[model samples]
Target: MRAVTYDSYASDNSRLKVGRVPDPKVGPGQVLIEVRAAGVNPVDWKVMTGGLDGMMDAMFPVIPGWDVAGVVRGRGPDTPDFVDGDEVMSYARKDVVGAGTFAQYVAVAADDVARKPASLDWNQAGGLPLVGMTAQRSLDRLEVGQGDVLLIHAASGGVGSLGVQIARDRGARVIGTASEENHEFLRGLGAEPVAYGDGLVERVRELAPDGVTAVADFVGGQLDTTLAVLAEGGRHVSVADNTVDQHGGHWIWVRPSGAKLAELAAMADRGALTVEVAGTYPLEKVGEAFDASRTGHTRGKLVITP
Candidate 1:
């Protein structure tokens, strides 16, 4: 199998390399996927740059990706639910530093994956797992529901974009903040689009007279203003900078959840959810893919196809 790996840790994507790697073998209860597409996330770069070195599981020469969508080519004994030829997508648990769907073939634990939405192609499914699950868990943690209003920071971003659509589908009034360039797209996704910058709090308040019941801030690092927008007893979840404290709600780091992915996949299958792709690159160009993901300006997701 062809794969991309990093020899050193730096924020630089130049360090990534493409090479031939032996196919992975499934463990007693693992499944081997014929990877058609892989989702690129912010953490992919963090892993390459050794940003997660403090985590005891960090391993060098890692394959830095979690979101994977593809066909099931083989299954190991003890894994009974899925069969060969099944299409599945997932954000495989990161208990080990790097072992996921970035190559032509990947071995993932059976408990970590779910059937892909039949409505989405390999390209779209590739980008769904991580961001989609992040959005779902945030809303679930916050108890976001009908009749509530939501203010999403970076609503045009990966998780935020899906979160906005999900909240809208659940009958919640949604307001989103993005750059002026992405305002129209956000509005089309069923949110009142507001430009993010100075005086963002005032602008959101103007749009939501009663106040926003929840705030999911994907863009992190000192979000006092974002926390201020949350209504009393509202949920405040941060996918980035999880250590940051807040006034009212708890912080959350998106964990791998097959059940959540199942729910999200079902939504996509029903056309109640959609995956947007900003760009795609060959696995050999994983360096370039990661570069694009770090820009913080991708219209949606950056992906790598095998």
Candidate 2:
């Protein structure tokens, strides 16, 4: 199988390469997938640059990918829900759990693999898992629904874009914070986009005249800005950092769930959801894509096709 992996914790800005490697083996409770597309997330590059390598579970010479989409090539004896030839999507567990999907094959645990939405191609399917799962889980944590007013930061980025759409689908009126330039793009997605700069709180207040019922901060800076606009007791969920302070919300980590992924799949199947591919790169160029992601203004999900 051809894979893109670095031998050491090389700085992505300095050195990273892509080439061929051996295929992965499927162990008990795991399913082997012939990788088609891999979703590139911020964590992949962070790991590459030694951001996460300090953790005891992170190993060197690691292939840093979590989200995957492909056809099943093998299934463990205990994996009764699926068989070979099934199309699947998965986010390989990162801790001490497993490897990644940056290669042409990945052996992911069966519980982590969900049927890819039939309406989406491999790249879309691959890109949706991590960000969609994250957004869905974050909203779940926020408990957003009908009549609720939700505010999402970094509205044009991968998770935020999907988060805005999902919030609206669930009957919430979403107000998003992005740059003035991407405001139109976000408004098209059913979110009222506000400029995420000085006076963000004032701008958001103007949009939602009532009050922000919830805040999902995909952007890390400006905690005070989020707090200034949040309704008392409104959930302030942050994906990148702490959401805790005077606002009284929780810090959220994106959790992988086959069940939640199934729900997102259903929405996409019905055309209630859509994926915006900001860019596409082959596996060999993943490092370059990763570098771009860190720069802070991706229009949508960045993907890597193997």
Candidate 3:
């Protein structure tokens, strides 16, 4: 199988190469997928650069990706929930960094796989898992619900965009922070848009004068802004900053859950959720895909058509 692999960590992406590699082994309770598409995320590049090395173990010649959507080709022992030809998706982050989705085939634990949303095509499904799960986990931690006014930092980015939609579906009023260019895009996702950077607190306050009932920080370094606009008893969570925990807010690192992924699929099918694929690259051009993600300007997800 042809897959992307990196032998060492470096600031440059030169280490990422597409080449023939042995097929992944299907462990017990795992399913083998003939990958159709994979999502490129910031963590893909960050892992390659050793940003997460101290926290997560890595195997050499590492294949680096976690978001995948494809058809099940085989099943490991004791896996009875799916069979050949099932269309599925997974946020397949392993305990270690390897056996990733940026390949023609990937072996993912059955517990991490969920049926793909019938309403989404391959590209959208591939891009939805990681971002959807991260956003869902953040919202769940904050207990966003009806009567809440949620303030989302970087709400036009991949995870933030999904977070906005999910919060809206929960009957919350959303105020999303984005650049001036993305304010309208955030508005289209059912969020009141406020430009980020200086005076973000004031802008969000203007939108929710009584105070935001919850805050989801997708981009880091907004602890001050979160503290300023959050209601006295409101909840807050951040995926980007651990310091949030010290400030009485929860810090989230999303876990893979088939049940949660299924819920997101249901939302998608019901037209209450949608995923945007900003660009798609072939497997051979995965470095370019990574570069695009690193730009941090894409309005939505970047995908690799593997």
Give one clash count per candidate, in the order shown.
Answer: 0, 0, 0
Error of 1 at 68 (Å): 0.5
What TM-score does each of the candidates earn? 0.95, 0.95, 0.98
Clashing pairs in 1: none
- Per-residue CA lDDT of candidate 2, range 1-306, in tens? 777767776665455566676778778988899988888888888777777545536554577788889999998778887889999898765565236788888888787788999888888888998888888888998889998999898988999999998999999998888888898999899988888777777788888766788988887875787778877777788877763744577777766667778888899999888878888888778867887898988888888888
Best by lDDT: 3
Give one digit per residue, the lDDT tens place, for model 1 in 1-306.
Answer: 778877678768776787877788888778888888888898888777777778737656677778899888898888897999998987875687766577888888888889988898888899999899889888888788998898888999999899998998889988888999999999889999998888888898888766778888777853676667766667677777565553555577778867778998888877788988998999778878777877888888888898
RMSD of each: 1.5, 1.7, 0.8
TM-score ranking, high to low: 3, 1, 2
Q: What Cα-based lDDT does every candidate model obtain?
A: 0.82, 0.82, 0.92
Q: What tens digits encode model 3's per-residue C-alpha lDDT throughout 1-306?
A: 999899999898788888999999898999999999899899999999999988999998999889999999999999998999999999999999988999999999999999999999999999999999999999999989999999998899999999999999999999998898998888899999888877878888788888889999998999998998988998999999999999999999999988899999999999999998899998888888888888888899999988
Clashing pairs in 2: none
The candidate scoring highest on TM-score is 3
Candidate 3's error at 2, in angstroms? 0.4
For candidate 2, report its TM-score: 0.95
